[model samples]
Target: MSDDDLAATLATEAGRLLLDVRREFADASVDDRKAAGDQRSHDFLMAALAAERPDDAVLSEEGADDPVRLSSRRVWIVDPLDGTREFSEPGRDDWAVHVALWQDGELVAGAVALPAQGVTLATPTVATPPAAPQHPRIVVSRTRPPDIAM
Candidate 1:
């Protein structure tokens, strides 16, 4: 599959896996849910990337920061689970899976899978978003906003 397609597919699959994990751990503690989600999703993503792109290096949030990725021409940067807190909380749809491919110092492909929302936004095949409101609102973290947002 093409890099763009691979990214989108992997991200979507990972998101599905996370949803399953969440359901299985619904009655467990918050920490347990978060840990399971992170490890399972990370493992799934790593295995899929290794099988699909054997020669490419991967840098995942849940995996070690391998120095080999720095020298590789193609690297897959992934976040198996982006919002651990929200993911562990029941009924929250803010969590997501992120997959991005960097080639020769440039981003070649990327995808964000929102499993709870049943949305997968991917590059090269993304649709134009609807027009914004007359007064656009800036959304930032409630507890800690970025410097730019400040």
Candidate 2:
């Protein structure tokens, strides 16, 4: 499979794992739930990458940063759980799983999966940017609004 395909696939799988973790730990404390989801998804993605792309290096939020990635030909940079707070909340869908490929100093491929919303946006399959609105728009999370926005 192409690098883009691999990125998309990894991201989708990671998102699914996050969803499963959330469900399995539904009654746990928010901190416990977040921790579980983060570690589980990270482990799944890292293991899959190691199996599928044994030669490539990986940089994951939940994993130790290996200096080896700097000299590697290809690196997979992943954020297993981008918005842990949102993911642990009862009814928030803003969290995402990110998988990106940096090859030869460039971001060759990437994907962001919104599992709760059942959406996966991948490079080469990414949607076209919407037309710019007449007014400028700044998007922010409802739960953690930036202090400067006030």
Instruction: Highest lDDT: give the candidate number.
Output: 1
| Model 1 whole-model lDDT (C-alpha atoms) | 0.94
lDDT of each residue in 1-150, candidate 1, tens digit only? 999999999999999999999989999999999999999999999999999999999999999999999899999999999999999999999999999998999888999999999999999754468998998767568788777677
The estimated TM-scores of all candidates read 0.83, 0.82
Q: Write the per-residue lDDT of candidate 2 for residues 1-150, one digit (tens) a residue.
A: 988888888889889888888889899999999999999999999899999999999999889999999899899999999999999998899999999988898788899999999999988753568999998768577888777566
Residue 9 lDDT, candidate 1, scale 0-100: 99
Q: Which stretches of candidate 2 lie over 4 Å from their true place?
A: 125-150
Tell me the lDDT of model 1 at 150. 71
